[model samples]
Target: MRISLMSTTLAQGVIDWSRDGHVLTAEQKKFYEREGYIVIRNVVPQYELDRYQKRFMEICKMKGVAQSMTVMRDMTIARSEYVPGEKAIMKVQDFGDDPILFDYCKYPAIVDTVKDLIGTPNSNLLAMHTMLINKPPDSGSLTSRHPMHQDLQYFPFRPADFICCSWTAMEKITRANGCLVVVPRTHKGPLLPHEYPKWEGGVNPMYHGIQSYDPKMPRLHVEMEAGDTVFFHPLLIHGSGTNRTNGFRKAISCHYANDDLCRYVDIDKNQEFTANEILDVARKRMKKYGMSEEEAKAVQIDFADIWRLRARAVNGVRQHL
Candidate 1:
C-alpha cells in the first residue's frame, strides 16, 4: 500500500474502501485502496480451474448450445477456414445463462472476496458480466492486444464505488502470454470517454477503448500462476498485452456488484456514444440472421436494457439489477 494515511477522512467520518479485518486482511485492503487491485494467490484449486477450462473448451467445440452467450470471433481469423472452432474465437461473453460456466461466479472463494470489496458482507450479489477470454498467438497483426479502458464506461450503474471485477488466471500468465497490464491508482479518477482504436487490424466487436491516456503512466504487468484470482476496481485503467507465445492464453472473469445496493442509471450523451456502437453491433447481428428491419427495431433495447437482460443473481435474492 503506497497511500499515505490521512487524518482528514477520519475527521469527516468518510472511511471508504479500506477497512481492517475481513475476508481481505487489513494489509490487502490497504494495497487495493492504493493500487486499485489485489491478487489473491491460490484462491481456486487446480481441479476447479480445470473444470472451467473444460467447460470453455466444450463451448468452443460447439458441444452444446450455450444459450444467450455471445462468441466473439477474432477478426483476423473470422473468415479463415484454416483456424477451426476454438482457434477462431477471441472471447465468450455473457455466459451467466450457462450453469457450468456460471459456476465460476458462484465459487465461495470468489464470492467472499467480491462481497468484501463491494462492501456487502451478506447481501444479494449480481453478476453484471462474465467472460472467458482466449488470447491466441498474434499473427503479426497486433489484434490480440486489448486496449486500456475502464469497465465503468460500459456499465450503467450508480455509486460506482460498490462495484468491482474479479479475474482468475486459468494457467501461468506472463508478459509473453499477454498478462494483464494495469495502471495503478487510476481508479480514483473519473471515467474518461471511450472509442474504438483505429488499429490496422480491426478490433473485435464491442471492443471500445479510451481515446487517449497518459503515455508516461507506468504499467504493471501482472504475472500470476494458475488459479490466482485478482479483484480490481471498475474504473481501473487496464488491458492485456499481445500474446507472443504460440500457445493461447486463457482467463475467466466477472464483474460483480451488490444488487441490493445498486440501481440502473441513465446514460448521458457521452456514454450514449459508445452505447449506440454496442447497440449497432447487436442490431447488425439480428439483421444478418434475417430479422426484418422493422422487427429488429421493434425489439427496443438500450444500454440499461442490455445489462438488465444479462444481470443474474449470483448470491442472495435478486430484487433489482
Candidate 2:
C-alpha cells in the first residue's frame, strides 16, 4: 500500500501533521498523530524474545559469530574494573548479519506495522538501524540514562513522516527500572539542536541529546510488559533513564524507513554539529579497522555512505537510504 503522508500547516506555534493507515485501525492512527507514538500489545511473541535473549548471552560468551556486529560495553565498566563480559556489555549495534538477531528485523508483525505507519509499500521498507540495548545497573556511574533526544538527530533522511522506530521490550519495563520516557507531541515541532549532555560522570559515545527543552512539557513514562512493542516517529523526543534495579533492562529496536520515499540530505545548518560528531566517529572506527588517519581521510566516506553501510532491506527493494 502507498499513501501520501505529512502535510503540514503551522498554527499556534505547532505544526499539524497527518497520516493515513493501512494496517492501523482508525483509532490507532489518530492516537499516533496526536501522541507521536503507539504501543501495540504483544507484537513480539515470547518465543522470539527468548531467542533474542539467548543469542545475546551466546555473544557475551564469545560463542556467536557476527563479524559485522558491534558489542558496546558500558562506559564505567569499559574504563575501570574487571567484570564478566556478560554484565559489562551494554548494547549491540548493526546485528543484521546475525541470523538469530536478524530475525527480529524480518519479523512479519513488526515489518508490516512499520510499513503501515510509514505509509510505504512492503516492497520498499528498509531497516536502517538496529540495536539491542541492555541498560545496566547504575553502579554509581550514572551512565545508564539515555538523555532526551530525537532519533532524527542521528538520521540524515528526509520526509520524517516516512521513518519510524519499532522498540520491543524483551522484559517487563517499569519507571523504576528505566522505562522509555517521552515528551508528548514533540514530533509536531521542528528538528532541534543536539549535543552531549553535561553529565557529571560520563555518557556512552555518540549518545548526544537535546541541549535544551521545556522542562514543564508533560513527560510520559512508557511502562511496558515483555513482548510489547511501541512504534514511534523519528522526530519524537524520547529517552530512557537509569536502571536502578539489579538486573539488566533489555530491549531490541529497529528504525525503518520508506526506502522509496526517504532520501539522504546534507546536514542542514541546524544539524551540522551532529554531522561533524558522526564524521569523527566514522573516521575513528576506520582507524580501529586498520586504516591510517590519512587513509581514512582519503576514503571520503560521507554522511550518506555511513548510513548506506547500515541500511538493509527488510521488506522491500533496495533504494537510496
Candidate 3:
C-alpha cells in the first residue's frame, strides 16, 4: 500500500541505452505520454514469437487442461477449472526446468522493450499467464467484458505505475474476437474500482477492492494485429470484450514490475501501507474508527488470507500435467 516504489536497479540499465523509438516511436511516445498506453507493433520477432506459443499449447495438451473458449491461461484459468484430482496450468515461473520456454523469456528483444519502458534491464518476469479464447463458428460462450480498471489496483506497492505487460498475439486478434481496449491517460490518477463480477454464483475473479471509474471517463478499444504487442502503465484501466467471431483468440500476457518497492501481496484484501515500519498500522487505522481489538484482528486476518491466497497464486510453478 504505502511502500516505496520498486528500486532503480532495473531502471538503471534501461536509462543507459533505451530511446523512445526502439519500442515506442516518437509519435507513439507522445501518444503514450498523453493517453497512458502505446501499441508496440512487432516488439517480438515472428520466429521467437512462434516458439513460445507452440511450447505453451503443447504444455496445455500434455497437462490435459480442457480447451475452453472463455478462460485465460495461467494459474487463474487452471485454478478456476481445477479438479482436485487433475493437474493445473503450466506455470512459467518454473520455466527454468525447460529450455524452450526459459529461452523465450530471456529473449533480447523482449528484455530491451521492457528496459525501454520500465527503465530497467534487470526486470524480472512478474507473471507469464496465457489466455485461449475458443469460439465455434456459430455458437459460443458469451461473457461480459472485463471491467475497466488499472493493473496497479491489484498491487499498490510499486511506486506510481512502474509496471509493464506484453500480450503476444498467438492468433490474429480482431475486434470481433475481443481485443483489449484501454482508457487513455487514466493512469495519472489513483485507481478506480468496478463492481465485482459474479461469474457463477459468487465465485469469480477477485476485484482487489477496486471501485469502478467515473461514468464520464473516455475509453478506447485497442485493436492489435497478430505478432504485435501493447504496453501500458500498470495504473491504466483496460479490459476486452467477448469473442463474437468464428475463430479463436489466443495470447500470452507477460507482466513485469520494478524490482524496487515491489512486494508479493494478496491483491484481494484491504492491504495496509504504513509510512514507517510499524506493526500496529492496522490497529491504528482501526483505533481511529473505534474498532475493538477483535474487529481489527478480524480485518487483518481477512487481509492476510487474501494476501496468502494471491501469493500462492503468484509465484508457484505449474508445468503441464
Candidate 4:
C-alpha cells in the first residue's frame, strides 16, 4: 500500500516535520490528535519476529525462569489457578551488554518509524530496556498486569509533550492473550496522583482514581499481532490485563525524547526536574552499589547515553533513531 506524506511544510523559525513522514502518516497524526494514540500494524517482519522469540526463550531457559505465558493462560477468561517459580529473572533492559538485542532495536524500519513519529532524525537513543514476562502453565504465579497510568507520571522530564513510547509486540497479543487497554482522549488533561491499596499481596496493586478528564467514557482495547506496535501520548491512560492464553506475551518497550526538547517538567505536578536530577539520583544509587559519593556525583548523565540505555527495544533490528 502506498502511504502518502502530508507535506505540511515546516516554515522558517518553525519546526520541520517533513523528514519523519515514513512512520508518521498524515492519518496517524489525526488519530493521535483525536484519540491520543495510534497503532501501526505489521511493522515488524516475520523473520525478525522469529529471531527475537528464539533469543528470548533461550534467555529464559538460561535464567531458569518461565519461558512462556502458558501458566497464566487461563486468567484472561476467568481467574486461573497458577503460581510462578522462583528462578525467573528479567533480562533485556541492559540489552546493550548483548550485541544481538542492541542491533535488533537499531533496525532501519523501526528507527524510521520513530523518526516519523518524532519528526526528527537526529533524535538520539534512549535506553532499550527489554523484559520477558514468563509465566508457566498452572503454576499459580502472580499474574503480571500494568496499571492504567501515563508514562510521563513516572518519568522525570520536562515539556511533558515531546516524549513518546514504542511498544513492539513479540507475542501474539489478544483480549484473551492480555493486550493493552487505553483510555482514549485522556492525554489532554492534567496528570493525576495515584496510591492504590494492595489488591492482593505479591500482585500489583489495583490502581484507581487517577485524575481523569473523562472517567465516564469507555476504555479502548488494543489487540495486536506480533510485529505490530502502538504509540501513544505520554498522558494517555494505558495498562494491560493478565495473560490468560497459556503462553508468553513478550514485548520490547522503549521511551524516546526529542534532542531539542531539553526542558524537563513533571507531568503531574508541572514541576521542573532537570538533567541534574539524574546526576543526583545516580550518585545516591551508586553508593548502595558500593561506589563512593564523589565517584557517584562525578557520574555525568549523558543524554545520548541515557537515550541509548532507556529508549525502546524489541527482538528484531528495530529501534528509535
Go through the candidates in order and give the clash count of each.
Answer: 0, 1, 18, 41
Question: Which residue pairs in candidate 2 have backbone atoms (N, alpha carbon, C) closer than 3 angstroms, thus clashing?
Answer: 123-316
Cα lDDT of model 4 by residue, 190-285, tens digit: 666644323452343223324433445689889898888887767788877665666666676556554444233322332123233444544565
Q: Which stretches of candidate 4 lie over 4 Å from their true place?
A: 1-20, 61-94, 125-142, 201-216, 265-321
Which ranges in model 2 have alpha carbons more than 4 Å from their true place? 1-22, 120-123
Give Cα distance to truth, residue 223, candidate 1, Å.
Answer: 0.5
TM-score of each: 0.91, 0.91, 0.62, 0.67
Alpha-carbon local distance difference test for all models: 0.82, 0.82, 0.50, 0.54
| Residue 193, candidate 3: C-alpha displacement in angstroms | 3.2
**RMSD in angstroms, all models?**
5.1, 4.2, 10.0, 8.7
List, residue by residue over 1-321, the lDDT tens digit for candidate 1. 112221122212222455663578777877887788999999889998889888887888767645568887788888777667668778999999888889999999899887777655676889999999999999889989999988888887755666789999999999999999999999888788888889898786667788886757998999999999889988899998999999989999999977766677776455787788778877877887889998888887877778888898987788767
lDDT of each residue in 1-321, candidate 2, tens digit only: 223233242121221224444567767867887889999988899999999999999888767757567888999889877778579799999998888998999998888777667654434888889999999988887889998999987887767877889999999999878999998899888888888988998888888888886667799999999999999988899999999999999999999877777778766566788877878977888888899989988887777777888888886469677
Model 4, total clashes: 41
lDDT of 3 by residue, 158-255 (tens): 44444666666656777787778787877766645445554442322332324545547677777777677777777777776666775556565555
lDDT of 1: 0.82
- What is the alpha-carbon lDDT for the whole of candidate 2? 0.82
Error of 3 at 145 (Å): 3.0
The number of clashing residue pairs in model 3 is: 18
